[model samples]
Target: MEPNGMKCAWFQFLIGFEIMSLGAYFPMKVYVYTHDFEEGGKENPKKIHFARIPVIGECIVLSNNPNWYKVVLVLHTPYMAADADAEVWCVKITGSAARKAAGYSAS
Candidate 1:
């Protein structure tokens, strides 16, 4: 096999491994949400809100603390395949200060 072909094979293997690992470690319910935005006009102002829905096969990792959770937003694009597309966009519902003040306790 050519060098590039070999590299691509290895890359795919690594990505599969990481995704399996994540699934094993942080298994939880995943919720899909979307936001709608309307263009503002003189007669009507724009309003936007995010609504949660169910998406199949989406990975969701729930934190016991209600602050931290892992959400699988989407598959990594081809450009990011080298990194195993394992990069997950993390969101913290609780602010950092609050966590620090609580000594990093969920309670």
Candidate 2:
């Protein structure tokens, strides 16, 4: 009975390993945001809590409107394109440093 239990455990482990090797599981991506113009530059202000979403590609887009300096981050899974599921990250930049990092410009 003890040997059979060990065998069952080993078989389960092998099955899990095979599934993982086949890429059946996908991990979520992480992104950090901070205010650079504050007292600590990069170290002064702590990062704020942000959202988490499934992703295949992640990037930031500069606002097209010249009057607004905003960064739009889109997190999406290409596999779900047929389903049209995507999430957007909205962050406001206050100082020039943060703006520059976010590719935000008045021009």
Candidate 3:
């Protein structure tokens, strides 16, 4: 039987591989920014965030500063089931030094 373009037999085989090869891997990072600006001479603060979708992980970068920098988010999902029925999601965040320093001052 085939479901969602995936054959049952293939699903079994893939699931086996997924289970056996479930291990941590290197993470990846990315930077994102917004074009929108806030009132005054300063740009609006962009909401920086990231998320891992069912099958596709996304990284969103946002900043109020004119110079936009890419912030990479690295994550690892161990033992990801490949049964074609398994649903998993993960995301990691890495803030810049500038942001951290500013946050410290604010606090």
Q: Which one wins on TM-score?
A: 2
Against the true structure, candidate 2 reaches a TM-score of: 0.26
The superposed Cα distance between candidate 3 and the true structure at residue 89, in angstroms, equals: 23
lDDT of 2 at 53: 46
Q: What is the lDDT for 14 in model 1?
A: 100
lDDT of 2 by residue, 1-107 (tens): 57888999999999989876653344333233322343354422222223334222233333353322133455454574333234344344445645665588834
- 1-107: candidate 1 lDDT, tens digit per residue: 57998999999999999886775565432222322123221222112122232233333333344443223243332363342322333333335544564578645
Model 1: pairs clashing at backbone N, Cα or C within 3 Å: none
TM-score of candidate 3 against the unseen true structure: 0.20
For model 3, the run of ten residues with the poorest summed lDDT: 26-35
lDDT of 3: 0.36
Please, what is the whole-model Cα lDDT of each candidate in the order they appear? 0.39, 0.43, 0.36
Model 1 worst lDDT run, 10 consecutive residues: 41-50
| lDDT (Cα, 0-100) at 80 in candidate 3 | 44
Q: What is the lDDT of residue 52 in candidate 2?
A: 39
The all-Cα superposition gives candidate 1 an RMSD in Å to the true structure of 14.4
Segments in model 2 whose C-alpha atoms lie over 4 Å from true places: 24-53, 56-107
Top-lDDT structure, candidate number:
2
